[model samples]
Target: MQSTRQNSQQMDESDFYTNCRAVYLTMFKSSLENITSKEQLCTVLQQAGRNPSQKTLNKYWGPKTSKLNFDDFCEILRKEKPTGRSELMQAFREIDVNGDGFITHSELYKVLTSKGERMTREEVKAIISVADTNSDGKLDYKEFCKLFMSTTEVCQKRALERMEADNKMRRQQFGSHSEGFSKSSLSHTANPSLGTNQQAEMDVTPRKGEGKSSMRPSSARSRRASVSSTISMGASGGSKTGKLLMPKSVQDWHHTALKGCFFLEEDGEISSHQYRLDVPQTSTVFLTIKPMNLSQVEEKPSSWMSVDAMFFIVKDHEDLDDMRVVCFTELREKEKFGWKGELSSGVYYILPFTTGCRLKKKKKNIKEQAQLVCRGEGGKLALTKEFRAALSDIFEVIDLDGNGLLSLEEYNFFEQRTSGEKCDEEAWAVCKENFDTKKNELTRQGFMDLNLMEAIDRNGDPCDLWVTLESMGFNRALEMVEACPFILDAHSEECKLRLKAVNLKQSSKVLDTAICKSVMAKGEAKVMKGSESVTIYTYKNDFRITSVIANKSNQKVTIHVNSEQSKNCLSSRGISMFAVEVPPRSNVVCQHVLPINERQEWIYNCTESLVA
Candidate 1:
């Protein structure tokens, strides 16, 4: 029996070798890349039911831990899509601890801790709590998977919030000192009737700790005491060492005080906000004030201050840029901060500020006028200079060979370094074959070459492009598209249309858009509501005027254009601007020219009447 088993194993090994050679020849039609091992290749053959010896497999695939050939197997599976989501789920369940439909928080913690997570008990508990959305004492498997899948989003939001809070605190502390000078100067200006001599005397001298009263002179100099206003030397008037008189209003203000500052527009009035300052001067002078909280309807005190007015004494022209000045709109509480006598409120920005130098507005054609000058779509993006500088700083990291455009090989190396995943050389080679070989180098044009819309446009023919980015995951590629100039900040009709095409073409799996195109209608569509009108258009000439579609259950009809048309085109049977005046159920179709891609495909779009 032992001899027979040995013979059977030998026979299986021979069969596997023959099958592998055949598959390689049929696919690459060339010799495989340099190889010192055959283990993974043998495993594939065995998995395909062609038997092979363990020794033979090891020779082809190297050590099991190498993962080089395993990556190739995965690459083959991806191209074939041999198994779907259900199979992947089953594989995932093999490692899952909980028997419940999903993985659990405790199970994850156990696995990660066993894997050597460098965290403390409390830290682990905190992280788990955040993931356990159901708050049923533990995280369900679905929740656990969600947490793992969106790790990038989770970490980004938390980091952003923490940085914003830290910046806010720093600005408040620093601004207090710098803002004091301006507040004092503004106060003097507001009450200018007090005579010039008094103003001159006020500017007499600067002393240490000039703002905070705690740093004043000692009481031993009482003999030199003069008028009460001369009490700058010490707590009491001069060095008299006498008890100081205090007003009830001042005491009330201090007791209810929430220490902070606010900014106001140059032409804005602070009276509506309600609080008043008796001594709104530089430093630590007491302010006799009243609540501006809406609940306190009194008219005497205004609550806010202008940023310029408060900081005029200390600020220069440069400080005006990239500065965020906030005003304390609410009073402080033991546990939470809120407005005095109001339901709930806190500090907010008084001035709209950016984090870096602002850009001067660009003059453009009248037809290309942007709606908003700053931070608006198609408008000059905020801090363009800063963004460019940052990209310059990190460019070297991505440009491994410093040749500028990242070659497929160089990009694969980058992916492994940044994503902890290795590329499947076979799959990558398959994808590379689809690119224009004449280009030779992977330039921006080469990347855009993969864009289905671009492919259709260049060929002047419409067919679904099915190229894939092997090694680079769908999410990573999506990020690159988002940052690209053609996609980011695009708002015009043409740009928006192109953006949609890019999005549809870059989808992870092949999409079914034939249905979307078949349903399109041709010609201009007119819609009318009580007082509104709208226009509808289709991408291609194939669409016929179909009966008006209206009043379907809650799912309002939206216009669809041929996947190839500019993304933002109007469509027949869709709610474009022309339908604004058309009433739903009042069916009407008009014949007119409609734009189409090179393929002559279009989809129906509803008019505003559908919305009505």
Candidate 2:
């Protein structure tokens, strides 16, 4: 068989551009004037047996150069044709079986052994390791071409060496046999007719396409030559040593071979039942958990469908482990979906079906719904009698000073003692809003009217809090209070203290407006007393407290700032110092920061009380 080097040399000598130029000119009818646009040029190229995408055309005839003359067109063809690589790509595509643009171990193994070659698993792995640069255990077009080109070079060199060796051996044997026959006396002793017949046999040569003559040697040398011929035939017939390596199974190719399709049923009932869709042997299937009501059924699918849940099912391949079913929840509209995790072999009622989407209208008021759900069919008395009595006892203890009405200071003291930390001022504010009466204090009756304990019990249930929050327009504070009743008391106490310290009346029409502006602007507000002002900035997870203390008296004042929260508040400079000195007629600013969960009560006192 001819070596790859020889074949390449032949191809080089065959005037490739001459043939391409002729084809191009023929497509344009011997003129290039009418080929004005890139689309026109692509058509001409395709008609001439060249396949190119729009991107390929743009690389040569770019957007800047709209028109191409004959000379430039021919020049591009010569420079960008990729003759050898194109042939290699064609062969690769043929072996790629599934046409996934990647050559998998199975496809490679099948193609290599199709011509009677056997490959082991380790050998296949070695071949893949060489070209699988991404470590994905598959060869893309570029990698496959690189592997094939290298193998071809090696095969050519080996074939050339074998041919040269065979030629040398033939020469040595011919000379030795000729010398021995010339010196032998057997020819003289034999009959002249017999000698003539032997000479005639020696002079006759085998015809083309016929087997080697019977006169050839039947020794080790001849057997080696036969084996070399077989190897050459295998190489010439599109077989490569690298192709014999096959991966263990199809799983190795799944990362590239697997594809998914998602489907949603309109007005489908949500149920806790297993649904099955027949999957293709080598494909994956994904189903979106969207349950649409009749009102939402528009002529065109809206992008706002609640895709809060989804699941995937993969067909079994080779091993049972390849078969997977996974479900995911807490998804949002237009959020990219993926498998949550591997699920066991059982029926799962995913999302909309179990949530009864079709049976109910789209929720318009989430907070109201959350409240109703939390109340349940058991009504407001969801708590047991013992739990209710325990709650009443707790409330009585918080009503400090024996006033029947719980003042903000009393509530704050109660929370500080119970939690063993400083009060969460934000939690206190929320409690005040929900349970405080017209007097700006939480009365026993007002506290019970809120049903704080029952709300907490309902919020702790296994219902989806994310969906509830979404319906409620994401009222995080309300959600937090409902989930934890202790926050209500804390917030209420904080509110009472703020109003009492500021001496603001609850009956004032401007009270709600003033509090709303400060709280709504940044979820926090600053309270000033005497010559000292404190602003607390509340975040989702932490709080920043900024304090300014001014000394109006004609003497220096020493201010002490201490955090009652569990987490020690750090100053802006990262120090734990709480005491700072202020000069006469001057002010001092001190800032403290801590995480929300670590917060307790905070106290600020001067060496001498300042007059308001």
Candidate 3:
């Protein structure tokens, strides 16, 4: 059920009208009397991070005319829309009264003067004049096709005229108050979405694990509202895109994010995603992080452009600095930086941070953004059996004197290389207390136990563990691994360039969206509630276990997550409390539950709302 006014008042610490106005001005920048259509309503839904199917959108949409205002946009979203097709397309089919696959002037006049704006005879004739190509004073099927699509050479001529007319009308209607961009200009073609005669820009933003920036010709992006307490970073102008050829197992998406970041204005957060790379045993992969710049895409477009971005790889809970910095380059040097040798397996994070996207914000500075791309050769994603075998081999190598027990000197030699810390007598005593030991020396099983403890401490992060394993001489036989969820820090100033995350779990319109969308492995997604105000999407991947939450409401929804069932979750080791605040009708993978072993079950509970 919807929150009552008293609940709203009690929950909201700020002014209620301000909240109302914020919701009111969600679409068209003003809700007062400004008309919107189904297409524009779809754009608004996209801005809120939803890619609902046409059928789903149609169920929620009202009116085929440009009469759906901001209030209609609000009310339609708040209500439950069942599965259905659009009545708008059906309306035209009904207009062809003779069933001859054509519409006549009499039919058009009968409908135009009766429904919607009730156009005058002159206006009806004007529409017929654009569609009737044969000069027969009647519209055939081909002529009717011209009304909806202008992709053909014959269709473009008349459609161009109609589009220019619509542009002129839009300029006159909103005038100085609007962004002043023509639909044709934004679409880069004369074939605008037909029938509604509304303006919409198709979103083509970057996505997760991406690290390149591209410039678009459209300049109708909104300006980013500057934050007074913004943290500043140095970035150069002009970035370039690079190619990534990595380990074979998980090598599906390989594009750098366009030179921009996803910035959530309300939360002051940026977009960050993870890409897993598997380094094969006994192989060294040469890789590079390529930076990109904004290409000049417009003669006099109305927005700024991104020219640079940043990309790096790290283990879970590790920062860019914590991992090795192979090669670092600024704006000018767009060349491939350095050669990559070997990376330890087990959940490495590839973070691409782009800034200064032009299409989303009207920033005049036009600062260049950074672009990052990664490429690697073929390598199998390591499994637990492979790791155990490799570790067993290492134990043999470490027991050099033929004895299976590790003495203080032998263990200290290992301790110094992986961590640079020598184990003292007290520490050795503690190790003996926790692990299998014999005659005050660590046995083979004890050594494995010691390493297992290290893995547990890092929440199963394999970077340090692999370092220890490599030092003991086993980097040649096996490589990296899977397990544990990662974090995504996405930041786009506005909706257009947000490169919004897709909830692939939703069987809706998404394939047509940008590349690099989440690749949730095939599994049954247990949805808690129906497609109502709240939804939960779970994915089961041997590499990473994650969950997505979709909020199908107008106002912000706070979700409570309880992981009482999954006792072995590394992040908590017990029940965890999480509150996630989701935007209206948004889809986001919010939970990162990391289970310890193959036997541990991953379960999570819910609570209050979560806002980010």
Backbone collisions counted per model: 63, 18, 62
Q: Which candidate do you rate higher for lDDT, 1 or 3?
A: 3
* Candidate 3 lDDT, 1-612, residue by residue in tens: 345764454334223222222333344433333434667766655433344566766665523233554434434444533222233346667887668767777877888899765778897888788778777756675445544443333433443344335434543443242234443422211121111101111111111122233132122111110001111111211223222233353233222122112221111112322234433233343333333211234564211112223344434323312333232112223322323344443444344433212112111332532111112244322225556555665554334333678888666545553465888999888989999999888898787666666666665557665555533322233421110011222211211111222111111112101001231222233323211334454543332234555444343343434343344443311124333444444554444443343243433333222211
* lDDT by candidate, in order shown: 0.28, 0.35, 0.38
Query: Which sequence of candidate numbers ranks them by TM-score, best first?
Result: 3, 2, 1
Q: What tens-digit string does per-residue lDDT give for candidate 2 at 55-140?
A: 67877664335466543454456556533666978977887778888987677777655544455667677777777788776789
Single out the weakest 10-residue window by summed lDDT for candidate 1. Answer: 198-207
The window of 10 residues in a row where model 3 has the poorest summed lDDT is 222-231
Which stretches of model 2 miss by more than 4 angstroms?
1-88, 91-127, 133-138, 180-612
**Candidate 1: where is the Cα deviation over 4 Å?**
1-523, 529-531, 543-612
Ranking by lDDT: 3, 2, 1
The TM-score of predicted model 3 comes to: 0.21
Kindly state the number of residue pairs that clash in model 1: 63
Most accurate candidate by lDDT: 3
